[model samples]
Target: MQIVVKDLAFGRINMSIEKDIQQQTFRNSYQKATVNIIFSANWLTEQIKIFLDEEHITPQQYNILRILRGSMKPLSTLQIRERMLDKMSDTSRIVDRLVLKELVEKKLSTADK
Candidate 1:
């Protein structure tokens, strides 16, 4: 993996990517872009993981919190899944964990009836 380092207004920032996964360079622009997007996602995930670890929360739980906070209102499990980065995630299970931690509150939505 190549850790690209760059200097910005804040200071030097580093992003890690898996370069060893493929020995040859990308065959085309699309291929390169695909790898770049995955790399960026993973890098972002790592940053989020480090921050959430201190709060004793998993990345999935942290993601749910962000979605709920962004809505500024309560959301149903289906609604949360629709808004999440990983739509395939088990919103109900993840919410249960967050609710256990007091990081989230869940109530039966009016629409659920």
Candidate 2:
């Protein structure tokens, strides 16, 4: 693994995978496989989060925008909330922020009536 040191205080963090794991510690292959997969997923998520930090948006917010863009239709706050991967307690607040950014708009459809 290739490590990157961001701060001299916190020590080094892994930034890339340069080597493959050749040894297994567990007797149960299935359990070991599952653990390895989950560990890899979390590691990947952390790497992505580091990249996303530059954008000043959380992963949840990114997901919401992706969902809204995919819909191509004006989605109500409730609809957007329902489609979000992260069920935020304040969907209105999130939508409001997106609206402020001009990334999304809020409009009442006839169905709302």
Least well predicted 10-residue stretch by lDDT in candidate 2: 1-10
Across residues 56-103, which tens digit of lDDT does each residue of candidate 1 receive?
878677678777777856788888899888877898999898778777
RMSD after CA superposition, every candidate: 8.0, 8.5
lDDT of each: 0.71, 0.67
Question: Where does candidate 2 stray beyond 4 Å?
Answer: 1-24
Model 2: per-residue lDDT, tens digit, 1-113?
Answer: 11232432323654333233454366686867776777788876887687657656667767677777678577777887898877754788877776786666677799878
Best by TM-score: 2
lDDT of 1: 0.71
